[model samples]
Target: MALVELGRFNRNEAHILIGRLDSEGVVAIPFDGEASIGDGSYLFIAVRVLVDEDDLATAKAIVESAA
Candidate 1:
């Protein structure tokens, strides 16, 4: 299945959201989470949260409700 972006957030927030999604049975991952580490600006870089394309709608609902 193709991976699609759910949203972009800082590393911590992305991981939090991943955990939330996981609890709801949706598999998610962070993209570009380490790119900013090299420049010491990780907090300012936006990490993308990705999910399976088929799970996009459900993931969106879970994230939105949690917000």
Candidate 2:
């Protein structure tokens, strides 16, 4: 399955979004989340939220609605 970036968020925000998507049956993963741990500058780094390309539209709608 091809993955596409749905949005960029901080680590915590990414987790929240992941949970939100999960509730809607959309599988999303946060990239760079681990790498940002312990540096204490994680908030400065943008975490990438990715989902299957086929689910892009639905995921986008979910994220937009949350916003």
Candidate 3:
């Protein structure tokens, strides 16, 4: 499946955005949102928006104004 990243949101913001998408019936998930640690380690507490290929434009548009 093709995935597009919409925005890099803080943990709370991401959840709110996810709630918005969920309401709109768009299939979305949170991806990598974090600070990297030493030795290729990633610490993800926040969430990055991920959507299907077809949802890229819409998702980008939605989050564009969200920031």
Candidate 4:
């Protein structure tokens, strides 16, 4: 399954969305979260939320509704 981007968000927000997706049975992950750390400018960097291509639509809806 190819991973596709759902959206970009701050680390905390990405984690929250991951939890939301988890609760909804969608497997989502945040990329660049660790890379954003150690610079103290982590907030300036956006972490990407990725999900399986097949789950893209459902994950998008869940994210949109939470917005």
Best by TM-score: 1
> In model 1, which regions exceed 4 Å deviation?
none
Candidate 1 TM-score, true structure as reference: 0.94
| Residue ranges of candidate 4 with Cα displaced over 4 Å | none
- Cα miss at 40, model 1 (Å)? 0.5
lDDT of 2: 0.90
Query: Residue-wise lDDT of candidate 1 within 1-67, one digit each (tens)?
Result: 8999999997888999999999989999899888878889878889999999999999999988988
Over 31-55, each residue of candidate 4 has an lDDT whose tens digit, in order, gives 9887756878777788999999999
TM-score of 2: 0.88
RMSD of each: 0.8, 1.3, 4.1, 1.1
Instruction: Please give, for residues 1-67, the per-residue lDDT of candidate 3 as tens digits.
Output: 7988776777778878988887877778887644553545454445778889998877777767665
lDDT of 4 at 55: 99
How far residue 32's Cα lies from its native spot in candidate 4, in Å, is 0.5
Model 1 residue 28 lDDT score: 97
Cα error, candidate 3, residue 53 (Å): 1.3
What lDDT tens digits, residue by residue, belong to model 2 across residues 1-26? Answer: 99999988987899999999999999
Best by lDDT: 1
What TM-score do all the candidates reach, one by one? 0.94, 0.88, 0.67, 0.90
List lDDT for all candidates, in order: 0.92, 0.90, 0.74, 0.91
lDDT of 3 at 3: 83
List the candidate numbers ranked by TM-score, top first. 1, 4, 2, 3
**Lowest summed lDDT over 10 consecutive residues: which window, candidate 2?**
33-42
Q: In model 1, which residue pairs have backbone atoms overlapping below 3 Å?
A: none
